[model samples]
Target: MSSPPLPLPHLALIGAGITSLTLSLRLTSLGIPHTIYEQSPSLTELGAGLGFGPNAARALEYIDPRLVEIFNQTATFVGTPSPQGKELLLQEGKAGDDKIWIEFLDGTKQPEEGEELKPEFVIRAGNNKGHAAVHRGAWLDVLGGLVDTRERVRFGKRVVDVVLPAGSKGRVKILLADGTEAEADGVVGCDGVKSKVRQVLMEALGEGREKGKCGYSGKYAYRCLVPWGKAVEAVGEDRAGVSSLWMGPNRHLLTFPVDKQDEKFLNLVAFVTDESQVWPERGPASLTLPATKADALGDFEQAGFSDSVLQLLKVTNEKMDKWGLYDVADRPLSKFYSGRIMVIGDAAHASTPHHGSGAGFCMEDIAVLGALFEEAIARQRLTVDALEDVFAAFDNQRRERDQWLVNSSRRAADLYQWRIPEFLKPNSLEKMKADIEQRQEFCWGFNVGAAVREAKKHMSERLAAYK
Candidate 1:
């Protein structure tokens, strides 16, 4: 008699963000069949700069080193913008309301002197040491293009709910927005912070209404982009080529460069930790709220930062949007799986952007998950009925590490805003520089390939228990 087909012959992915795409890459490599559902009409990314470290870059080797290649090709070193075009950028201000002055927290102005700081002053806030930066839109475009089965990605199909079939070997049924339904042997939630699949799973497990909800992390970011020529003219050439993180009490500002096509753009992000400030939208955990340049300027003035930073924001094109930093730590998940359903990436361990390792951590999940699936298929030991092993192995391997990131990012933010009492002394700046360097080592030291190997081993050990 012919052998029965594998249990997970078909899998369904909800959401087409980076996590979904990365998982698709791995499953396709193993010749696993799956389909991706995206609520967005098209694959597009908003926001400003994105980055990951050297260790996270290596994780791409598991899927395709070409991902790292695409990143390197499009990425601009933080702080470096084209100097030859600085004059033109300053002249071609988008709104024609460009301010020509800069101010600093040190009570001195740029192009004027007041306690000059070295370039390393940028990373003194305990940041990713090997960070490589890229435009959010550009990186998304590259990853979306690299999918071998683009046709498998379905757009405008929002997943509303998911339920497992009554029988053990039956498929998991997924309901979509248009009242249509799809079935798969397994389902993975890559739906990000506001995940519908996660909602379904949480509701099923009786985890309570508030157990898995995302909430504001008591911080908001004023994210904007300025033309290359203008940023150089405003911040000057020397400061333009080196990335800097200005950390003050309860606030921090960072600047980096994004290379898109032939033009280089400077990405400016200013984050504030204010309990009094509220997002314009009082509705549920919305992605972002509309913002104005004047709003950002007013916030900066209160932040007590230099006017030089304000000069760059003044010339940025379009209305600056203030993104409330909403993370999952409000209801942190102690477990990443339930039955055959699993939540990955932001849906599982959403973190603050303080470490700049969020994207990197998502990729690591894909690597380890792929490894587990690959091993099971090879052993012919994985079937829909054996999903206990899949869920157990993934959570056992990933739960603490990913959640640690959630907690670590919160701690890092506290340090950056000087909320931590240990970093509050007069000599605390120097102490922070030393202390954070060691603390940040784990952020860059994680090896995704090794992580996958370890997960695979745990999966086998767990599966054997059933026999």
Candidate 2:
């Protein structure tokens, strides 16, 4: 007799952000049927600068190698450092010599690079390699286009509730805002930090509400896009590519380029401490500061920030468009899965942007989830019990990596928050150079693809044993 037909996996993904979009594409490639319910009526590009690291770039490659090529065509790589470009400042070593260095807490050293490495206050700056800064919108457009409309990515369908049915092999039901409901073999919540599915899981598990909280990062950010011509007139045309980071007491400023076809826009971001933990509910046009331009600029002016950085803030015509920066911690969740429901991306862990790894982490989630599902289907083990096992394994594999990234990102923030102090700071520029050199491996050495493959191997063994 002929073998029974293989069961098809039906996935319901909530939210249509980059994480959801990438997951949709991966599901399609694996031939796993799925549907997406995006709350937004239409996908619009939001946010400012996005720094895609090598790991994130690799994830993009897995989805579509052409994405990398398309990104490179419009984006310029930051290479050499210029006076008009971005700068990193360091102080002289304890030896009181003309050279400066970065002293690590672990007793490592990094030397200064160029003539800017003066003894009094050294500035050893170089271009950030293997990293590309692009407009948020441009990146979204590439990922969004990957979604096949025929695959059923429904827009304007807000997920109101997730109903977990009792008993084995029962389907999970997703209630929508339009008084409609859809049942699926499984549901993936990529709905971001404020995830309704997460709420349901927490309540069902008796975890109680307010158990996990998301708060502002004690920082307010001012972001704007300035025309290249306007920026050049202020900072000089030669300073276009470098991502300048200016550090001061309790505040910082970052500027980078976002290239389009014929025009290049300068993305400027300034962060300062705010007493309130709530983010701005409006945009830049609604922000009103009692402080003058000088006060708002603060110590950034003393750090020799470019005129263009100051100009962008001054020229902003509206305050409502300005947004505040907020972040969530690595909160303990009761679980990542319940019955036929699971969560991924920011819905699982919403971290601070200090390390620029939010998008990277989310992409990693998609890769891991996709790999597990692929193996289950290949083995003809696509039942509710099999999926639950997959979810458990996926979470176990990801927990450590996510926590490490979160801690590392927080440490990076502390390092960049202050200038080199006398006596306590590095003694020589060569010594400072050595300190930074030691950290190179740790910063760029992550391999998400390898981790995913390994996790799948381990998980497949566990699933077989359980069977």
* Clashes (candidate 1): 9
**408-436 in candidate 1: lDDT tens per residue?**
88888788777899778786666776656
- Whole-model lDDT per candidate: 0.71, 0.61
Model 2 C-alpha lDDT per residue in residues 43-70, reported as the tens digit of each score: 7665466766445655665565566567
Worst 10 residues of 2 by lDDT: 86-95
Which model scores highest in TM-score?
Answer: 1
User: Residue 437 deviation, candidate 1, in Å?
Assistant: 1.4
TM-score of each prediction: 0.87, 0.79
